[model samples]
Target: MEITILVFGQIKEITGIAAWQISGIKSTEELAAKLVMQFPELALMKYAMAVNKILIQTDTELNENDTVALLPPFSGG
Candidate 1:
C-alpha cells in the first residue's frame, strides 16, 4: 500500500519537502522506524502523526490511501 505523508514545521525543513510518499507501510510504529532509518535527521526530533486527519498513537493500523501528517510542536505566544 502507498501512503502520503505531510511534513510540517522543522520536519519539513529537514526533509526539504512538504509531502512525501512511501510504500509497504503497515502500522504507525513501522512507519516511524522506517522514517528514522531513511531520514536519520528525524531520529533527533519529536513529532506527532495524524492519519487521515485523525491523530494517532504508536502501533496504529493504517490503510491504503490514508494520508499521514507528521507535525512538529507548535510554537507561538
Candidate 2:
C-alpha cells in the first residue's frame, strides 16, 4: 500500500524532507516501527500518527493512499 508521510520539526531535519510517500506499510505499528528503525534518532522524540487528519494509535490499521502525518511534539507558545 502507498501512504503519504509528513515529517515535522526535527523529523524533517533528520529525513531532509517534510513530506514523502511510503510503501510496504502493512499496518500503522509497522509504519512507526520502520520509521524508528530507519531513523533511530526519532526514537528519542515524542510523536503521533494521524490518518487523514484523524489521530489514531500505532496499532491502527492503515489503508491504501492514507495520508499519515508524523507529528513530533510542539513547544511553541
Candidate 3:
C-alpha cells in the first residue's frame, strides 16, 4: 500500500518536497518513526500528523488512500 505524506516548514526543507509517496502505514506512531529514520532531521523537530484532516493519535489506523500531513510546530500568535 502507498500513502501520500505532505510535509510542511522545515520538514519540507529537510525532505526536499511538499508531498511524496511512501510505503503503507502500519500505525501512526510507526509512520512518524519511519519518517524520522528516512529523514534524520525530523527527529530533532516538533511535529504532528493528521489523517484525512482529522487529528489522530499515534495508534490511528491508516487506509490505503489516507492523506497524512506532517506539520512542524507553528509560531504565530
Candidate 4:
C-alpha cells in the first residue's frame, strides 16, 4: 500500500523535492488526484507518468513499494 514517487524536470520544481513516499494510494488515477491535491500547481502542468520505469498510457494499478515517476514535457537536441 506504499508507493515511492519520483519527480523530474518542472515537476520536481513544483514539488520542491525529487522523491517522496506515499501510502494508501491504489492506482495511478488516485495518485494523480492526490498529487494535485498536495501540489495544486501540478494541475496546471502537463506531464507523463511511469510505473516502475514503464510509461503508462492509462490508469495503472500500483503495488507496495512500487516506484512512480512524474515526468514533465522535455525537449532534446
Candidate 5:
C-alpha cells in the first residue's frame, strides 16, 4: 500500500520536503507514528491531517494511492 504525503506550512519545513511517498502503512495512526519516528521534530508540533483532501479528526483507514496531507496551524488577518 503506497500513500502520498503532502506537507504544508511549517510541517513542510520540518520534513524538509513538500511531498513524498511511503509504503506499508496501514492506517492514519500508523502513518503518524512512522512519521514521528522518522522526523522526531514532528512529535512536538501540532498539525491537522487530511486524507484525499478531507480533514480528519480521528484516525482513519488509508488505502493504496491515497493522498495524505499534513497541515500545520495557520493564522491570518
Candidate 6:
C-alpha cells in the first residue's frame, strides 16, 4: 500500500518535504513508527494525525493512496 504523508509546520522543516510517499503501511500506528525511524526528529515534536481531513486518535486502518496529514498544534493570531 502506498500512503501519502503530508507534513506541516516544523515537521515540514524537519523532513524538508511538504508531502511524500511510503509503502507497506496498513495502519496509522505503523506509519508513525516508520516516520520516527526515518526521521528521528519527529519523536521530539508534537503533532496530530489525520486521514482524509478527519482527525484520528488511534490506530486507524489505512488504504492504498490514503493521504495522511501531520498537523502541529495551531495558535491564533
Off by over 4 Å in 5: none
TM-score of each: 0.91, 0.88, 0.86, 0.94, 0.94, 0.92
Better of 1 and 2 by TM-score: 1
The 0-to-1 C-alpha lDDT of every candidate, in the order given, reads 0.89, 0.85, 0.84, 0.94, 0.94, 0.93
| lDDT of model number 3 | 0.84
Model 3 lDDT per residue over 1-77, tens place: 77889989888999998998877576788888898899898889887789988777657877788889988887888
Which segments of model 2 are wrong by more than 4 Å? none
Estimate the lDDT of model 5.
Answer: 0.94
Worst 10 residues of 3 by lDDT: 54-63
Q: Tens digit of lDDT per residue, candidate 1, span 37-63? A: 988999999988899988886579888
Q: What ranking of all candidate models by TM-score puts the best one first? A: 5, 4, 6, 1, 2, 3
Better of 2 and 4 by lDDT: 4
TM-score of 5: 0.94
Candidate 4 accuracy as lDDT: 0.94
Tens digit of lDDT per residue, candidate 6, span 1-77? Answer: 79899999889989999998988999999889899998999999889899999999989999999999999987868
lDDT of 4 by residue, 12-72 (tens): 9889999999999999999999999999999999998999999999999999999999898
Which ranges in model 6 have alpha carbons more than 4 Å from their true place? none
lDDT of 5 by residue, 19-58 (tens): 9999999899999999999999999989989999999999
Stretches of candidate 1 exceeding 4 Å from the true structure: none
lDDT of 2 by residue, 1-77 (tens): 79999988878888788999989897888988898898888888787778889988648888899988888888889
Clashing pairs in model 6, backbone N/Cα/C closer than 3 A: none
